[model samples]
Target: MKEYSIREDDLTGEAIAALLRLHLSEMHQWSPVCSVHAMPIERLRAPDVTFYTAWDGDRLAACGALKQLDARHGELKSMRADPAYRGQGAGRAMLDHLLGVARARGYTRVSLETGRPEPFLPARRLYEANGFRECAPFGDYVADDFSICMTREL
Candidate 1:
């Protein structure tokens, strides 16, 4: 498989729409608390949220977001690797790239909320492999039985 490159400029309107569609079609059912599942593409764009997209050659392979919660804290949002690229390390690469961006932006802590179902095992494992540990819910997320929260201190 080809190695992917993460680029800030790749996060465009069309790319965001594609990502949203992929998330809705495949990953929405994977999470009970995924509010963005049916959200409009335009709504995903905001000043507080910065997005990144991974590219394999000219193809968009994955995308993720970093929402600045505070000067030293950020939240992971909309992390989705395309179905065609699953199990090819694109998801891990995107997470690493997002973390690097968060650290560069002076964020001391980063956290995420994902489902706790069996289908979400790989996602939790990926977060753990990247230094994220189980933590109490942050941001607007509450302590949900169907959701698992993870945080990493940079």
Candidate 2:
């Protein structure tokens, strides 16, 4: 496998924009419009969020973000691996990078919200494999059949 490098993204590159568009498209496909919680580029650029892009040399392999919920908690947002790079460790690399950022920020816990449909099984498995456990909704999320929330302690 090619070496993957993760970097904080400014969300200004064309490749980044294209990847985000693809991420939102996939999210909408797997979940109802009302249930889709993937953030747009503008939201990912907000003061409390940090966006990252992973590269396999010159190719963008994945992207993800972490949003500070409070001094001790953070939320994972918009985690998506490029279709061409899926199952190639890019998602794991991105997840690890974001979690490291959360730890560096002094967060004691990190959580994420994702669709509950079959299309999301792989993502759920990835999180579960990384020490995240299903939990009650956190942040502004609610208990709904279409959404599942998971959290991990730093």
Candidate 3:
């Protein structure tokens, strides 16, 4: 298997910024403006969030984040695999990395909100494969047709 290096990233590089924009653009396209839950680069920079990026040599393969909600909870945020890197295990690698970080940080649970549209099915499937199960809205989220919430115990 091809190797990837995943590490905590500062999100300041041009490539990383572009990837984040792509993630947000795709989310906005699939859901209404108000329903788009992907965080912007600014929000991802908050002190409570740890963002990461995966690289295969010089190429940016994927990115994701773990945001502490409290002492025992964290939320997965802004997971995205570059189009060219899809099916190359980039998404799984990023998810596993973030989950490990959450566990190391003492989080007993991790949850996320993702779009409910057809374009998001693969993402939901990925989370399910990693043990996430459907749940009611979490954090500040409320029930919405455009969103689906999932959670998993660490």
Off-target runs (Cα >4 Å) in candidate 1 are 10-16, 33-40
Clash pairs for candidate 2:
none
TM-score of 1: 0.87
Candidate 3's residue-wise lDDT over 26-118, tens digit each?
Answer: 887888988988899999999999999999998999999999999999999999999999988999999999988888989999999998778
Q: Any residue pairs clashing in model 3, and if so which?
A: none
Give the lDDT ranking, best first. Answer: 2, 3, 1
Tell me the lDDT of model 3 at 45: 96
TM-score of each: 0.87, 0.97, 0.97
Candidate 1 versus truth, CA RMSD in Å, comes to 2.4
